[model samples]
Target: MKGSRRAVVLGLVLTLAGCRKGKEEAPAPLPPTPAEAPAPGAPPSQQQALPPDMRRALSSIAPLVESVKAAVVNVEVRDAAPSHQDTPWNGEGPDSPFGEESPFGAPFDGPREDAPRQGLGSGFVVDARGLVLTNNHVVEGATRIRVQFPDGKEMDAKVLGRDPLTDVAVLKLQGDVKGLPVVRLGDSDAMRVGDWVVAIGNPFGLASSVSLGIVSAKARDIQAGPFDDFLQTDAAINPGNSGGPLFNLHGEVVGINTAIAGQGSGIGFAVPSSLVKELLPQLEKQGSVTRGWLGVAVQELTPDLGSALGVPTGKGAVVTEVNEGTPAAEAGLKPDDVIVSAGGHPIASGHALTRTIALEAPGSTLPLTLYREGKKQEVVVTLGTRPDLEGVASREPSPEQEESPQQRVGLSLSDMDSRLARAQGLPRAGALVTEVVPGSNAERAGLVPGMVVVEAAGETVRRASDLARVVRDAPPGDALLLRVAVPGGGRVLRALTVPKQ
Candidate 1:
């Protein structure tokens, strides 16, 4: 009985699943009507569904892509290990820059013969004179560099100069070739998000590979460095795509493919070639690029900070610290001031401030509008050479730092040393409290990280051991007074009375 019931249920289920209604299928289709179509050789009705902007964009860009491909060349770099043990820096003997302890200081594994190691990149001829622009990282350490044309013809190239901070480099061929198809540079500032862009590069050793996509974003700060105004595009830039041209719809070079977001798809960044055009002349004229430096550490203005500074829109970069005797400080700039404008351009963020300052020529005077302590002040600052980038900043500490003590109250101290203070964006020389042990006397006294211990027991603290020595020689049962500058403000803290040992 159970088996029969199960069979009936299964049959019901199948019948329901496959059920078709009982219906008649008796109808004849009607013939075509003349009203629905144009009568007697008239033109058919036009459809208006296509977007006009898209059509215009496609029509304008089609020819430009092909034109751009003609000038974009593949770059091949060879980093051949020397036949003998070569130092890293000089590329010569063991005592070379790489040092004797360098892992790559040894020779190659195969026959002790010289072989040209190879790497592939992409670049476009910017001038008929054989001037090409590429990423600095592409050929910086290369031993031999070669540029290959679309016809498979190759020429040896020499580096004109390179700026690592911007990752821009210029290369020139040995001989000038006539009728060279040079790519015209476009204004990247005019680019808008979602605009179509094409990238041509040698991705994974595939030379002259073209990929298409739209500008995903603009002025993207990937936190690569100080000069990080990058154009983020999704045009399939990959490894070996570095140093290639990112072209706009008119076949104008807009950006240089410098980096791709790691381990990701459809995310890449390019350095705007407009910067290349701006900096190339300087690179060619001089051996290095010199940028204007403000010598102030700036912080982005958040909503709360803007409110505190009375900026309703939260615009501008706030000067958090100013280096003494530097351009900003010499111009009477101070901490707690907001840089609302530089060189007449509005300061939007820290990056914008850097970019604006960089655009100014070294030794030129730049007018800065600053908001300080509730008032707008204008100052003309003579720009200084970007010390670090140009290797102008004194790398060594001043003579005063050598006389500073080492230890203080379970904390390591150094002279609010020049190098340390400059690197840390501190204004004056004070005791730099390096480390305070957990549960140590200094830590218990509310001495936190980055505190410049200025005073101990009303005596000036010039070094780390100043605090330690003062505390050691202090009269028992007396509170230790410490003056330190916090991130937001400065305060004097009284350490709890400690019995002398």
Candidate 2:
């Protein structure tokens, strides 16, 4: 009897599930009939009736999709048979910038290690002479590439240039390619959130699939790379949809579908066309990108740090470190200096400064406005080529230090001894923090036990006494600013409120 009851319940559940799926896939309602239309020559009312064709044209996006679908192409790539050392292509590997469980619509791979691996992606023609644009990852290790047009025509193609930094690649189709339909690149800067967008691609080898969605957000940093300003959307971008074009309502390519949150998440990312356009000329000419480098590490200038430094809060990037012999050091830029502007553009944040400098060519002299010792100063520095950071591992934080005797502002401090300095890979010229009292101002200020206080109240702290002296001399009820070297290699500013005696 129990088994019979269980079977009945299972059948009921399946019936309900089928009903929901049927409702979801049901066809849309038909257009209004002639009897439902307003009579001819009737007095005009607020609700004016329209012909069925006019209503369909107003309500449907079929025309727009038809107009732009021709330029979309399917990109198929085949890799040479894998060697004994190579792992089979499961869409997760060192070649992919996105790590395990990659956000990109990773190409579908064949299922064998020794077999030639085949992958499918999407691309669009941007020039009548058969120049095409797609994502670099789509064709990164392929030994052969072929582009399949909507009309079932396939043509061999070669990589003209590729910028791995931007994940963009340009391909030139071979064999009499004049008069190919092309899509116009649009101004991504003008695209606002919530604007409607259409994505066309071959998802899962289903050719010529179109999905409609709105721009969910913009300038999203998914930690994909240093220049991660992805346009987030709710479009259904799937595997095999990589390198597809994202079109605006005006039939212009605003972005390139590159990554997705996960399968069936309805969240995807696209590279803005603005950044693509900026890199296209260089990629076409040099086949690689060269970014300008200013050899200074900067951090955000918070309100309390700004108050202690006598600069406007949230206005500039604070120099944390100036590498030796670099452009910043050569220009005499010191730690604690606040960079307010660069190249005539206001520097609102550290990211802004980095992006502004990177956009300029190497060897270009850039004028900078900075605040040092509560005074404004101007300097010019020549930028250098940015170093390749690929494959460089980040330093992990140091282990917690042993507790010390001296305590202030809820911190136990000690002068950096030779042994401690060597262990932490730091110079012996700073006061080392050994412990942080829970709920204390120092702990609240983000002071960890392994940090070294390098500067306090704009004065160098070579020992704990130096920090104590600076704190003692500081005004009562004011925030004490300290520049601290973190356990790894970066510096950060902390503002601690002096405890009331």
Stretches > 4 Å off in candidate 2: 1-58, 81-100, 106-108, 391-501
Candidate 2 lDDT at 312 equals: 58
List model 1 lDDT by residue over 53-118, tens digit each: 232234333345566677777776544332322211112333332232211112222222433233
Give the per-residue Cα lDDT of candidate 2 at 353: 86
**Candidate 1 structure, TM-score to reference:** 0.61
Candidate 2 Cα lDDT to native: 0.71
TM-score of each: 0.61, 0.62
Backbone steric clashes in candidate 2, count:
0
The whole-model C-alpha lDDT of candidate 1 against the native structure comes to 0.65
